[model samples]
Target: MFSKTCEYAIRGVIFIAQKTADGSRIGIKEVAAGIDSPEHFIAKILQELSRKGIIQSQKGPTGGFYLDAQSRKHTLADIVHVIDGDQIFTGCGLGLKQCSETKPCPLHNEFKKIRDAISKLLRSTHLGEFSEQLEHKLVFLKR
Candidate 1:
């Protein structure tokens, strides 16, 4: 499961990716409204993304947020790392810090495989490609 911040990050990336190359910049309010997210929270997420260089932000009249060329090159892993950190993908599912193949937890093998697959996909697929797949219903978000 992902955190709210992670969800917002994904949505923000996808939204920007969809409108990429249109020279359109969106404010935090607009992005929150479009994604049906809370304004303050989305703003914080946007700030984090900006700090991480995952999205570009401008100030003043023609300023807001937009995906730069770097955003197009960014993978889901990058976003996740920015918002949720590597721990989400790297930690043991059962909360066992020392769990490993030799001394596997009950769900270690299964969870590890799933985690690895998710990590692989997130690391390899860019936001642009992810947005296209999402638009085509190839990928579905539960919430």
Candidate 2:
């Protein structure tokens, strides 16, 4: 599961990708409204993303957050790594520090399989692929 800020960042990025496809930049207010996130929170997330090169931003009248076609190729795992690191992939399901194959937790084997699947899903999926689903209402970013 994603943290609330990660959730907003993912949603905000998708919305920005959809809007920026026309080659126009959008401000924090617009991104916040598009993704239904708080302006201040989304602003911070976007700024961090811009700083990290996951997304791009500009200043002045035409300044805002936007992603180039190439940047859109970044995977969901990249954002997850940026915000949450690899903790989910490497942590114990039962919250034990020493949980491992030899010293397995009760849920270790089962949780490993589930975690691997999720990791694969995130690593293999790109941000660009979601714009069409969102543009056509095939997916919803917010409940």
Candidate 3:
């Protein structure tokens, strides 16, 4: 499971990715409304992403958040790291600080394999590809 901040970050990223070519910048209020997330919280996540160069923002009448070309190269892992930090993925699922193969926790081996696979997938998957997959799923749902 992901944190609320992580969920917000993903929604914000997907929203930006969907509106990328609109030329009309999307404000935090609009993004929050569209994603059903808190405005302030989403704003904070956007700011973090912007500060980390994962997303871009402008301050003016037409100012808002948007993703630049470079943002396309970013993966879910990058967003998660920006919002939640890398420790979330690296830590043991059972909260064991010393979890390892030899010194395994109750579900260490199984959880570690799942966690490692997820981490790898997130690290290697780009936002563009993620958006495409999401779009496909949405289409399937509609059908």
Candidate 4:
């Protein structure tokens, strides 16, 4: 699973992508409300994302967050990398620091399979796909 910040960032980014796929801008309030995240938490996440160039933002009137065509092409893996690093894809499932192939934890082998599957899903899923799924009501970012 993703960290709380990672989860919110993914949700916020997808909402922005859905709203701004046509090169428009979406406010943080709208993104947070759309994904049911707290405004302050999402705002901080967005700020970090903007700082990292994972998403773009502007200040003042008629300014907010927007993802250009190239940005929309980035995968969920990219966002995960920016916010959470490669730990989720590389770390032990049971939080074992010394777990590895040779000195495997009890759940290491099985967890590795699941982890790889999740990694592939993230790597293959892009911002546009995130938007499209929401646009079609095939998935929900909120409860």
Highest-scoring model, lDDT: 4
Ranking by TM-score: 2, 4, 1, 3
What candidate 2 gets wrong by more than 4 Å, as runs, is none
Task: Give the per-residue Cα lDDT of candidate 4 at 58.
Answer: 83
| Clash-forming residue pairs, model 3 | none
- Please, what are the lDDT tens digits per residue for candidate 4 over residues 12-117? 9988989998888989789888999999999999999889888899888989999987888889999999999999999998898999999999999999999999
Pull out the clashing pairs in model 1.
none
Cα lDDT, all candidates: 0.82, 0.87, 0.79, 0.90
Of candidates 4 and 2, the better by lDDT: 4
Candidate 2 lDDT by residue in tens digits, 1-143: 77888888888888888889888899998888777888999999989988888999989987888999887999888888888889777888888999989999999999999899999998999888887888899998776
Off by over 4 Å in 4: none
Evaluate model 4: give its lDDT: 0.90
Please give the lDDT score at residue 110 for candidate 1.
Answer: 95
lDDT string for model 3 (104-143, tens) is 8998878878888989988997765645565556522111
Write down the worst ten-residue block by lDDT for model 3: 134-143
- Comparing 3 with 4 on lDDT, the higher-scoring candidate is 4
Residues 1-143 of candidate 1 have per-residue lDDT tens digits of 78878988898778767755476788877777777888898898889888888988899998988887767888889999988889768889988989988899999989999999999988998877755676777865435
Top candidate on TM-score is: 2
Please identify model 3 stretches exceeding 4 Å from their true place.
130-143
TM-scores for candidates 1 onward, in order: 0.87, 0.95, 0.86, 0.94
